[model samples]
Target: MYGVQINDDGTIEQMNDELAQACVNGLKNLEIHNYPQPINMEVSLLSIFCGFYGTSNETISAEGIGNIRKFNKLSANADKNYGQASSNGERKPNPWILTKILRYHNKDHYEQIIKPLLKKNYEGKKKEKQIQINQTLILNKIDLTDDFTQLDMQEKAANGEYEKEEQIVMDLTRILIYYEGETEDIYAIKGYDAICDTQVLYHKLEGTVYKQLEKININFKNKKIDEKDNSKPITVKHIFKKYASKFFKKRCKFISEDPKILTVFQGYKYKKLHTIDYECLQMYFYLIKETIAAGDERVYEYILNWIAWLIQNPGKNRELQQYYKVDKVQVKIDSLM
Candidate 1:
């Protein structure tokens, strides 16, 4: 029933070629609604599955045929464990892992199609990997995909379609600098969220897509001033009076020409800073000249709070973001067929 042949020697072997021909013959001999019908491309994958399952000995009954696609024994014992330990040593499964496993079979189907159809164009050689397959795929000989958006980014990411957020932050910082407009209604307007907004942000891009990554749940509690200074919001004037220059000043390389001077080293490697960004000195002068809340005092207070966050938490102070040399991962691509 499973398209396997049993020999007199009690050995079993696959009979795929014979079964495929038999299936074609069986369909040719069948008459649906008193009309002879021949198989065509209109035969859906589910229809083929139903035919196969209906022929199986276990699912020959009507109830068995109906329940063929349903899951049973839905209990802990039947629960097949999946996923592996994450970076933080917690076992968690990416939501789409099962779907990705199914797509793995698509590669086999793709290679089969490519051999018969695109064999002449690609010189009859099938690439071993997806990265290699991408070379031939760009020839535009076919658009087998249902739509341009058919490639699922979430699923592809699991199959190595994504880079770490930490690396992306460093890469973007080198190419673009924050420039505030000279006045209110002009070129670039700065936007902020009171809760999540720090003095900095980073963005990443792929093709026409862009994503902003930010540090969440930061320790924003300001340092107490002589016990009576409950952590209420301080004015720009109060910010200038204390905790502005002392904690910062020498640590101001974040605003300087080279931010890489801020790279804080651990035992062997630098700490990976994923989201946090910094205001540069050029932007500082830009902000002061533009003027806001009680003169340039507001700008000073923003920088002060940023510096305090870095200083107070011994974990944060690392170099300014190193976006200098372009990373090879971006420019590098395999030479395709």
Candidate 2:
């Protein structure tokens, strides 16, 4: 499924053109159903998988796919072994080692080449390594979790979960700071469980969309609290501000300022942020805000939580459409070929 060639020497080859073209064709054909018009777009499986997994790493290039193919069997075995090890709280066959093997594609040399090298590097310096990690988290204002205290962070980092959490924390901090002008205490809102509460709130509000509820009021102060300390409550109102019209416009302007960022959004058309797109997105913010401002507490909570979740986890947009059983925004092309 990973699109790449595995060489006999355990080197990974870039994706072949024919397969890429075929996959693009498939997605482009689906444009009539729910994709945007002018269905000419390049789709990257590596990008898709990374997004699906909530990974921020763009380093999973086509070559990485080949690297993964080499020891698909070994990875499965490692995963099974890792599961058992984790349940028993033993740290044998660290997932990071498996990850290194996959990325470098050196199954044969892992014992002779990789293990010994890593052992030499990390054997006597465990506490020092952990201290550095703890210091980095402190600098970022991310809470030092039990995972960080233990070896769980390193293990989860191998699979990108820990990295994903850090990015999410950073994004949340930025959102809070953008609205409140400082992340004085928001740094306490760290880790997956904390973020998952917002994710779950998103799903709950999504379900309420089908129901015609004109009432919505949300006491944000009560629902979400800093997991690290129940004493410090995170101001969830700042999260709602993230989806405010001003924020969307500012974000659009900021994103448009960078050529590379624009390229990612504009795609084949190479167009700048169009007035229509901006207005539509702004209108979405307005409608959502109006609903929450006028509706019941539960509705406000769900919408705000969903908005917060979207800010950090953007890959779920496609899945959101599926959950709602609807196509993405359908704009009239107003042209006939």
Q: Give candidates' CA RMSD values in order.
A: 28.3, 29.2
How many clashing pairs does model 2 include? 9
Clashing pairs in 1: 259-320, 262-318, 262-319, 263-319
**TM of each candidate vs. truth:** 0.14, 0.15
Candidate 1, residues 125-202, lDDT tens digits: the string is 222332343333222111111122112322333344333222222222222222222332111111222454222222
Local error of candidate 1 at residue 226 (angstroms):
62
lDDT of 2 by residue, 1-337 (tens): 1112233255433332332322222221110111112212422222222221221122432333333334233333433343332334232111222223222333344454444444443433444544453357422221322223112322333333422223333333322211121322111112333522221111112213213111222223222233224334222233233222221111212224442121112112223344556665776666654443343344445556666766665333523321211124232211100
